[model samples]
Target chain A: MASSSQIDLSGTTYCVLTGASQGIGRAIAAQVSKMLGPNSVMLLLARNKEQLSQTASLCESKNVKVFYESIDLSKASLLEMNFALNKSLEGRRVTDFSTSLIFHNVGSLGNLAVDTARMQDVPELREYYDLNVFNVIALNTQFLKLFEEVEDRVVIVNITSLCAIKPMSGMAYYCSGKAAREMYFKVLAEEKKHIRVLNYSPGPVETSMIDYVLAETVNKNLRDVFNSFKNQGTLLKPEMTARKCVKVLLNSKFSPGEHVDYFDDE
Target chain B: MASSSQIDLSGTTYCVLTGASQGIGRAIAAQVSKMLGPNSVMLLLARNKEQLSQTASLCESKNVKVFYESIDLSKASLLEMNFALNKSLEGRRVTDFSTSLIFHNVGSLGNLAVDTARMQDVPELREYYDLNVFNVIALNTQFLKLFEEVEDRVVIVNITSLCAIKPMSGMAYYCSGKAAREMYFKVLAEEKKHIRVLNYSPGPVETSMIDYVLAETVNKNLRDVFNSFKNQGTLLKPEMTARKCVKVLLNSKFSPGEHVDYFDDE
Candidate 1:
């Protein structure tokens, strides 16, 4: 384990990132590799192995070991699968390879329609909870274990949404799931003082999930409202958001128990 | 079906309430019975059959036909169980009933110290999510069908905690769970305009759950802090809290888009 005083990137650093195949997850993995250097071990977990391999290729081609696992995190069986994955990796003799950081960026906003009637449908409700809440909890439960004997700073960044703070039209289930994850991280931060847990609301970024929702049922007027925000050119880029997040994780000035919003920073 | 001018209490008014055996849930049932009279119906769901029987007996005497189901709502299978329960109840006279309200007031806080190392334990995490989130989502999904045909006011009140807004020690999991519920309600409120969804944070109250949490914890400083709040007479009675909640539910002026905290009123 590396000491906090002598923070050396040459020492083996392990980072487990979810949703790493595309969007913000892939960008985050890229940024972490550049910042932490070649000796750091990056475990990319997502549903798409092809994209994961592409991401792995982008990192520095030195001692950087990138491992990708393709699995559906929404399933209840993810807990067992994660345990097995950890067991398999236990034999690797990587000195100073401490799991110090965890990034929870896996989430999806399935369709956007303000239909109270359809909201109750079993399939819709199940998908909402599974993607938004269950996956986050399952992954976090698994990731938190790897930091048992942490010698340096341990950071867990939960990529929540600005929508989680308030409510939005046609996104009740999505909001509910995100809010659940936000609260979970908050409590986890307070309970586990040794590790820094950040419930980060990245505001509204142009992501595939948002695009799908907007295309589906965004009211003309509502679209105009969102367009105005986007036109202002304030929406965060995935890589830029990733950098800010990593900065926060690495910075010792920011306190452990806090909910940091990107909009709040502005 | 009652006309738009008349208050419609004729619909099945399918309500799913947790912790119905005692405290706020029982009070909510009593108030709903008084408000709706013989026209209203309640599905009393809780763990204690004897206590649920008492609640049912009391509610039936008020001319509010009450049906009790003894089941642990925290179980993972609750969503399926609730769906079946709703289906079985569908056979009873299909009146012009619309699902009017959903009150999620069931949760217990295990006042354990925050151990960062053990935070990843799967069993503990599962228990936390089950008690706080699963039941809330399950009940909302199951009863949402009852509100489909009518344009009546459908309300969901998720009982939350003050700790959710601010940080607290030892009660991290409890606070996180409540926060998750709060966010869920917020999203529900925004997405479903016809249905009045409220993420209500009720400050510390004299409940069996609170008593249990306090009894187990050995932190004198924390106990002193809680004692100060109690000594200050800020802690509300269960009945008073219930009555206030009823007022919020019945008040047409209370909008659906805001997070309501009881302490804010004080």
Candidate 2:
């Protein structure tokens, strides 16, 4: 409820957020709910039921109708069903909404290794693409359908990584997946003028995924580089990052024909 | 052999091209052979044996070692075999020289509308992704393995479309495939610093594919737009485009981590 009156989310009756269980997703959900009143409905999706419940409870004070689905989006069929169910619950037919905003914040960093040999051996390379690349494409397909039907100002915010822009030795697969998703959204934005698609590279954030990567990698050089980035004051907190994302989402300044990097603003 | 002295094909040792039977593929094969000289070798891959043989004959100038494999690159096993064969033919160990250069120029286009109602009904869509997206990823994976073993520079050129960059009706599936491939290469370029990758967008060329698209769709706007581009004297001939491509390949100025669009230069 912090300065929630500054932004108007009442018009945004329905907001869909993926990976809404914790970290940035949860923060975005909370911020969005506070902006909108109780009449507005927020749909949260994640794989963990307990975590999703916790997220819903955190946003309960906003008095908004909060809903969640504990489902893995990597499974295309399950995602399709969940999408259908969410539409049905809102009492709005799948094709009716004019303005729909989708935040694709779900991602996983599989492994970190500077050596190409070791990096390729990791099983998570393919899994990283499955979750980051395939899911992004599939979900975009689903959302585009609804956007076309509505033909309103649809905004798609894909949370990308700084590694996507700059070359890094470790986290090759994760970087590749992020870079692919970034360009996918850029192409989507260019081709479809109706939708405001932004591939925002949020640099680095203090998230559990980062901790996992730091713990798994044995390279001291990579760790030192990561630590330097943190010390440089480039790393953003989840709430602060979410605030910037919301500003961009609500702002009409962007032309929707290019990729927006969060650090580029600074 | 017109103005052959202006071009240098002597140092070019090994070359690999996909979809090398007909259309731009065949044209590139023939031109690349002439540019690379008699000692160099060309590995051509396509699905049509008869067409491959015919193209091989046209590309057999200057005693260039012409090798054609009528195997579909969509088959992962066949792709692996082709890579192994190329490495053996080069007389270098399997890990000696990474894939020197790869032209991911294979794709398919069908007159299909974006059927949001039945998103899965687009059968041709899968083939588009298989040829255009998945095959590119597979080839890059193989190339990355080779890159680690060799000290030489590797280049990957992905031939994408103008439709991938712009909006077009009735070609959503085709655009999606091309867009995905472009992004994949873009990310690969970012991830692997040693390999020079070019996500080249060729805009529109005078190919049979363009004729087919024009025949099926009512949108003459693209035709008119292309015609104007031609009127402006910028529509590149196949040979001219191929020569420009070879120039980029041979020149050291164009390095790793850059994307070049033909239209952008215009």
Assess each model's interface with DockQ, reporting 2 decimals per model.
Answer: 0.37, 0.19
lDDT of 1 by residue, A1-266 (tens): 22223223444667777888887888878888876654567777778889888877775457677777777776647555566447535665333564467788888875565453344443455556666665576666666554555524566778888666676665656666676667667656655656666777766666676567557754454466566767797666887777776666555344554667765553
Which candidate number has the best TM-score? 2
Q: Model 1: which residue pairs collide?
A: A176-B184, B11-B96, B11-B97, B12-B97
Compute the DockQ of candidate 2.
0.19
Task: List residue ranges in candidate 1 displaced over 4 A.
Answer: A1-12, A61-63, A75-99, A110-117, A120-143, A214-235, A250-252, B1-16, B31-43, B57-99, B108-132, B215-235, B250-252
Cα lDDT tens digits, model 2, A91-171, are: 666443334667788888655644532232322444555577666566667666655556444667788776555545555
TM-score of 2: 0.80
In model 2 chain A, the worst 10-residue window by lDDT is A1-10
> Which candidate number has the best lDDT?
1
Please give the TM-score that candidate 1 achieves against the real structure.
Answer: 0.78
TM-score, A chain, model 1: 0.84
